[model samples]
Target: MSPATALRRNSDLGAALAEARAAYAAARPRSAAQHERAREVLPGGNTRSVLIYGPFPTAMTRGQDCRLWDLDGHAYLDLCGEYTAGLFGHSEPRIHRVLHATLEEGINLAAVGQGEERLARLLCGRFPSLAQVRFTNSGTEANLMALAAARAFTGRGTTMVMRGGYHGGVLTFPASGTNAATLPLPFVHAAYNDSDEAARLARAHAGDLAAVVVEPMLGSGGCIPAQPGFLAALRALADETGAVLIFDEVMTSRMSGGGMQARLGITPDMTTLGKYVGGGMSFGAFGGRADIMAQFDTTLPHAGTFNNNVLTMAAGGVAMGEIFTPEAAEALFQRGEALRARLNEIGRQAGVPLGFTGLGSMMTAHFRQPLPDRPYAASPAEEALRELFFFDMLAAGIYLARRGMVALSLPVGEPEMDRFVAAVGEFAESRAALLRAGGIAG
Candidate 1:
């Protein structure tokens, strides 16, 4: 392409994106007004950073099944699934019944409840790595406690974490720079999916490295799956360095009944759980080899007022035991696998530079061909295209993350999947020229 032609194409792409944003803003006046109102009390009218996007986010009114109604009264097929926390979907009858029963029984019992033991037993039985477990209020707290246990057990202070890994709000390590909100810890960051680099870092800091934390699949960091041999390498490194390997399965736990660790046959020293494990309620858990977790019993102090709250415990027990059984987990994994393949096939047939990466009911769309192994490799042009795609999908009554993430819920079946695929096909056909010009085409 000539310089003049490239310039013209870029101009056209800008206009196209501008037109989409204008249409998005025009269609949802009420949402815009609500955002303005929220800005009075909330910073950027948002508490969660990931939900914020340009032209403002459409404030959701309610969700039923797999559908959500925005403040403007537009109904959408909810593909975001609350970032994998809504695996059971909105209005799961089993969970609701359990929650109602728990509420009727009473909340804030302020005592050790039988529900905690039931849930813990269920978790330990399902996941092989969990010889013993402790609960928390969220995944962040679960990871924090897990790291604390590692440090206490190993008698070391430094942690080795993967770059672009997100353990929690305060434990995030992006590919570049640092998150101001990140907890102040002695951390040595290594590239994701690069086992050699991880090994080197672990060996270099072996003496002080208490834990090597990693996500089986980078969740918020674009759903990039760990390549073959990557996790095994980390396992070996942890053994050699005497560092506790902590797998952050907060998001990827949905990959199987026992999580990615079980699915891949690589057990970590410690594992953290959250999201759907709470039956869509606030919950988190960290557990591992009894020997390491024994520190909590003796030296380490792990305490949270709501850690054993009856509601989460009751719902989680039912969620794992009754609702999302081992069979259901496997079925969802197959469903997601088929959906991802179909989406990629559509992109290929359309000759568009769009694809999805992820494993089993959790995936992220990217406006780039031959998707990179890490988030930092995504280009700014691709990001612009992703933003445009977000608007397009929203207009078509499909809801996903602005960052192109999709977490399929139990309520999302064949019909919803078909609609999503059709929407993607339409977007590819409509934006073929712009996508190609953005240099994302193969």
Candidate 2:
């Protein structure tokens, strides 16, 4: 297209986005009020950056089953699933019972609890990489400790992470420099799923590399699953270099009974976990071969006051042992696959630039013109579509991340999935003019 034509198209797209923003603000008067009130106490009216968006974020009142009610009295089918932490949904009966029982007994015993051991045992039996484990307050801590352990074991100072990876709050990767949160540790950022480049980096940093940390599937970085070959290559490189391979399964653990490591049949030296593993509580864990984890001896000292608290242990025990069993997880995975297939079909039928990337119950929609060769490296067009889709989906009563992430929980079923699909169809129809003008859809 010529410069004048391109300029006109850009101007039109900007106008449409402005209109959508206005519509969003007008629809959520109560949310806007709540955000204004929150801004007085909380910076930008948000504790989490991702939860904050333009015009203001909606203040959710309560959640039950698979639905969330916002301050505006707008109810939504929660496809974001609290970014995969709400795997058990808002109110899983088993989790509620376990938590209540634990609360009745005691919260912090101020010592090592038997419940921790029980949960640990269950985790060890399920995840082959976890021969022994240690608990933490959040996924960030789990990753921190895991990296520390790898460094201690290898006596090295450098760690390697993927380009678009996000291990935790501070462990963010190469974003637009808009966020300042990050680990101070020396990190060699490599491309996701590019085994050759990663292998080269690993070999180059061979002697000093302490750990090669990665997500089996990129969770916050657009829900892209690692190609099997890429994972296997990393495993081989770790073996060759004597570096500990740490799989950050904080989000991907919900993929199956044994998590993605099991499903992929590739094991890592150490694994970090969080999210629904705590049975909807604040939780994180790191574990690996017994020999490596054994270094957590008193001499080395890994300390956290609430690391082995009874509440998380009690709830987690029930979450893994009873609630999200292998059978249940398998069923959920199947349902997710079906939902994803249907969504892709709708996109194809509508001739939209919409696409999805993920595995099992986790997925993210992308507005790639012809879909991306890799999820991490997205075009500007894809990014713009993601922003537009977020607003459209929210208006349609489907709560998802602005990044287009949609995570499925056990409480969601066929009816909810159907409704979500229909909403996507409607959004496509309504936005056809804008989408076509921007070359985002037919």
lDDT of each: 0.91, 0.86
Question: Worst ten-residue run, lDDT, model 2?
Answer: 369-378
Model 1 residue runs over 4 Å out of place are: 1-11
Q: Give one digit per residue, the lDDT tens place, for model 2 in 1-442.
A: 5776545434566655766788899999998988899999999897898898888988899999999999879999999988898998898888888888888987768987789999999999999899999999899999999999999999999999987789888999853342377868888988888998999999999989999999988888878888899999999999999999999999988888899999999999999999889888899999999888889864368889988888898999999988899999989999999888888887788776676778889998876555543444555655666678888888888899888899999999999999999988876766555566554442
lDDT of 2 at 92: 87
Q: For residues 1-442, could you state the per-residue lDDT of candidate 1 as single tens digits?
A: 5776545434577877887899899999998998999899999898998878878989998999999999899999999999999999899999999999889999999999899999999999998799999999999999999998999898999999888899999999988889999999899999999878887888999989999999999998999999759999999999999999999999999889899999999999999999999999999999999999888878889889999999999999999989998899999999999999999998899887789999989999888778767757567788788888899999999999888999999999999999999999988877788888774655
RMSD to the hidden true structure, all candidates: 3.0, 3.8
Report the number of backbone clashes for model 2. 0
Clashing pairs in 2: none
Best by lDDT: 1
